[model samples]
Target: MGTPAISGDPKPQITFQTKGITKVYDTGDVQVHALRGVDLALYEGEFAVLLGPSGSGKSTLLNILGGLDQPTDGQVWFRNQELTAASERELTRYRRDNVGFVFQFYNLVPSLTARENVELVTEIARSPMDAREALDIVGLKERVDHFPAQLSGGEQQRVAIARAIAKRPDVLLCDEPTGALDSQTGVIVLEAIERVNAELGTTTAVITHNASIADMAHRVVSFADGAIARVVVNDARKPARDITW
Candidate 1:
């Protein structure tokens, strides 16, 4: 099925046509190879999971795809544009206009209410939903007026999620978004993300340390030693709360 973003206009077909994509970092004389010829294709509206250990380079690959980092070799094409060689200014514009990010911590503004914190991004986006609407999407309507300090960790993370989706980002990049919460709370956060991915049909990519989270993805990619060790295709995905070790 087509994504929610495939509305009036045609949604640009999303795919990776990498012949060989590699990332390398030079620390003085030492060299670290983060990615070794990653050739992968993630279609539009796909909910994909990436799992790996700390140094396995899953996050590195995600960063490159999001334009936060560039690969050392090969090309990354997001539709028609080549991201790997994009100028810094272009990368900034691409990030601001097309991508939404969710980190492990909820970096909400302490002084602003949940609505206002979300409003901060809505105000600057080219075209964005109202802050109230975004909050409602995450099932946080009642908590909209609460300040960050007044809410629980799960609530705060939901607010952050609301802010990210308000802009209608084409791609949602989440990095260990539930790592700080207990399993119960984390499931709530994951449910919020799942709802967004399913409802909004954002091309969602989540990087997680928890192996169980893979059960919810359409495709689960496991990284080992900077390479894809195994890819599991799930015919049926359980919700976050229903998944177990």
Candidate 2:
């Protein structure tokens, strides 16, 4: 069976392509290979999970795909644009305009209210959703005026999700988004991410070591020793609320 469609568009086009991608970090005395001869593709409006052990290169691949880092060798294409060939300024513009990122940490300004924190991105975005609308989508409408300190871990992560989606990015890249939370709170954060990907049709890639989380992905890419070890296409997907680690 084919992977079940989370978005109505089942046969969406490719959003990103990597050909023989490799990333090596030279530490003067030694070199660390983060990715080696990796080839991958992510489809538009798809939710893909990167699954692996710690230091298996999942986060490194995600970082490269999101334009945070470039491959030392080979090519990366974000749609028709060759990201590997883009200048630093162009990469910055691409990130600002087309990509949204969420990390394990909420990264909210402690001094700002939830709405104000989201407004920081919407104000700079060329065409953005209203901060309130974004918050509402993430189920944070009631917490708009609350500061980060006033919210729970899950709620703060939801606010971060809201801030990320307020710009209506083409791709949402999340790195261990629930790593800091307990199981129950992590489920809530995953629910918010699920809502964003399903409702907004953002091409989302999430890196997590939790193998159980793979059930929610349309496709799961497993990493091992700086290479993609396996790629699984799920015949059916469970909603985040239905998933349990």
Candidate 3:
């Protein structure tokens, strides 16, 4: 795909921009402040890793960017389009056409084969790659006919990845994608994500508590106490295969 409008020279196009974003959830008698005055931008085609402790706003920020949740305050933009001002229906369409998501759980239908699971998304997409091609991208072409029950946990996660990217989304957001797997399995999942970012140039952002995973990102955003604590640009990125616990 071609690049979006350039925000400036000498930098990749900005995919997401958030200004003073805040989110507060009311649980009857109590209120939880999730994000507080977070201002950040994710660059096009750059792989970013979000690192923070639990309840530190990393996931909250990601959810807002992915259009899964709306913030209580501040402004957010997908390229030049303002997401904070979008209607719910528009947000739904935006997510469907532009964003791809992967979570800790595989969420594959038990009875569906790996290719069939990925086909669920491709069937509804405007212009999608062949389901088998998507599976191939994640190194699962051989297992395309295998049911979820027949695959290992890592293989299942790769199928989830294939489902997400089958639509050729502009941005891929991963939330604790490898959280449920062992180190070896986590590495495999990470490699799939890395391949998607590198091969397809899908702008990618991952939420990971594992600090070692930061080496695989072009930049790392660290959150603390519902705000951004620091942002680091990696001088050189290490492949997921070289990343060890």
Candidate 4:
């Protein structure tokens, strides 16, 4: 047998592979070091949670990963493309084609119905999934026709998630996606995000102050003093809606 025939499965795509990433902010002669060289690798379709205390650089890291901010130093690569050195137009296209963002506040257009708000992004995207189908994945298909004002906070957040995924982006960046709601409502929002991640296989990173959310992630990174203090990989991940911690 001449070197038993190897069936090669092409290497799995890497969503983000960052090395020695740093972010610094300057305010009136004061230098704020947000991140001091963070090294991370997020494989395609991984669900990662960034956990930390207030003043930690989780948000800053997430922003840099999502193309909302550039690093002060170091290299940032997404799908083998160097995001850190990419031009503004290239970054914009990268964000539009490859990343989606969700924040603490449900940023739905109040004037638009749930479906319409999601449709807006799809209309501007290169290739998009159907808006109604994306909403359905978040358990909001029944509420698609309802305006933002007509929906509850949980419902609105679900719509916001649908909007984010409608573009069929490879990476989903969530900064405190459930921060603004009560625990009960927040759980619902998290469940919606979980459903999307499971169904769409979108690489996700959630920046959260709630350490409880860490159990739901495949990997949890703890940030302190603008640096990662710990990284834990949970072999058994708790579902968002089922987690009490």
lDDT of each: 0.85, 0.91, 0.91, 0.84
> Where does model 4 exceed 4 Å of error?
1-13
The TM-score of candidate 4 is 0.93
lDDT per residue as tens, model 4, 1-245: 00111112134456787788888899988999999988887766678898987778999888888888999999998887899989999999998998989988888889999989999999999989899998998888788899999999888888888999999998899999888888888898899888777778788899998989988887788888887787887767899878664
Candidate 1 wrongly placed segments (more than 4 Å): 1-12, 15-19
Off by over 4 Å in 2: 1-10
- In model 4, which range of ten residues has the least summed lDDT? 1-10
Query: How would you encode candidate 2's per-residue C-alpha lDDT over 22-43 as one tens digit per residue?
Result: 9999999999998999989899
How well does candidate 1 score on lDDT at residue 137? 89
> In terms of lDDT, which candidate is stronger, 1 or 2?
2
Report the candidate with higher TM-score, 1 versus 4: 4
Worst 10 residues of 1 by lDDT: 1-10
How high a TM-score does candidate 3 get? 0.95
Q: For candidate 4, give the lDDT of residue 44.
A: 66
Q: Sort the candidates on lDDT, descending order.
A: 3, 2, 1, 4
Q: Write the per-residue lDDT of candidate 3 for residues 1-245, one digit (tens) a residue.
A: 12222223355878898899999999999999999989888888889999988899988888999998899999999999899999999999999999999999999999899999999999989999999999999999899999999999999999999999999999999999999999999999999999999899899999988899999987888988899888887767899999898
